[model samples]
Target: MRKYRHLFRILYLILLLFVFVNLLLGFYGYAFTPLLWNPWLYLGAVTVFCHIWYRFYRNHAPNWQNLVSVLLSLFAMAILVFFIELFFSFDGHDLVTIHSEYYIKEKTIVFQRGSLLDAYDEYHELVNPFVMKKKIKKKVYID
Candidate 1:
């Protein structure tokens, strides 16, 4: 068991690094957006990581160092979750309600539950709906 301590430490560090990277990508927008949006996935990963840490340390006598490490790990996880929630709060409704539609012109149209309509071109650039409506009208008249 003592020989495996190094392995456990490596695994713990890897998990922490992964969580940090996930948080950074979440802030960067749409990079692992689906993963960030899923609270259950984050919760499960945190739970497993903490459980492994606890199980590993349980075999040894309690020490201040172990306790402090556990506390710091938990604190980091809490901060990560808080920031993610804060990010969601900024556009919570848009995330839950907006749906995207793809058009033949290689445009992606996003519809919000309310009155607003947003369109994005193939390059992911926002296109004014009024301009698109006029273009569609012209195409109809020409045909």
Candidate 2:
């Protein structure tokens, strides 16, 4: 049983990696924006929990360091991640809501929707329906 302790430790290390990456994905997914980080979408809680576990292992051990590591690691990761977002990343919510670009041939490209009212709002804000409307003038009687 003792020889397998090494095997168990190795497995624990692998698990830690999985958790860390999963958390990064989770945080980034929820973020769903372009930056040096934050993948630009909503990531689930499972992602966060898994990442917590991974970083938990890196700084802690079989000893009683888990509690201390968990607290500080979470704080550090949160601050670092948030700071990166604040200083570097775009507002993902905005990106997800509305976007526009022009092609060389004079066509504009726009995407406005998660398939809901928010989509319509984005379209209006970005696409300019008034400009897109057809123009016509009613004839008036001449005196």
Best by lDDT: 1
The global Cα lDDT (0 to 1) of model 1 is 0.44
Q: Can you tell me which runs of candidate 2 are displaced by over 4 Å? A: 1-49, 52-63, 89-143
Candidate 2 clashes between residue pairs 3 or more apart in a chain or in different chains: 19-50, 19-51, 29-41, 30-43, 32-40, 32-41, 33-40
Instruction: Please provide, for model 1 over 3-57, each residue's C-alpha lDDT reduced to its tens digit, 9 standing for 90 to 100.
Output: 4666657766765665576455445442222323344445555766666786767
lDDT of 2 by residue, 1-143 (tens): 44445655665565465446545544543211121112322132234544557555665565557666666766776675556444322222422221222111122222222322322211111123212211111212222
TM-score of each: 0.32, 0.28
TM-score leader: 1
Q: How many angstroms is residue 115 displaced in model 2 relative to the true structure, after the best TM-score fit?
A: 34
Determine which window of 10 residues in candidate 2 has minimal summed lDDT.
Answer: 130-139
Instruction: Give the alpha-carbon lDDT of every model.
Output: 0.44, 0.36
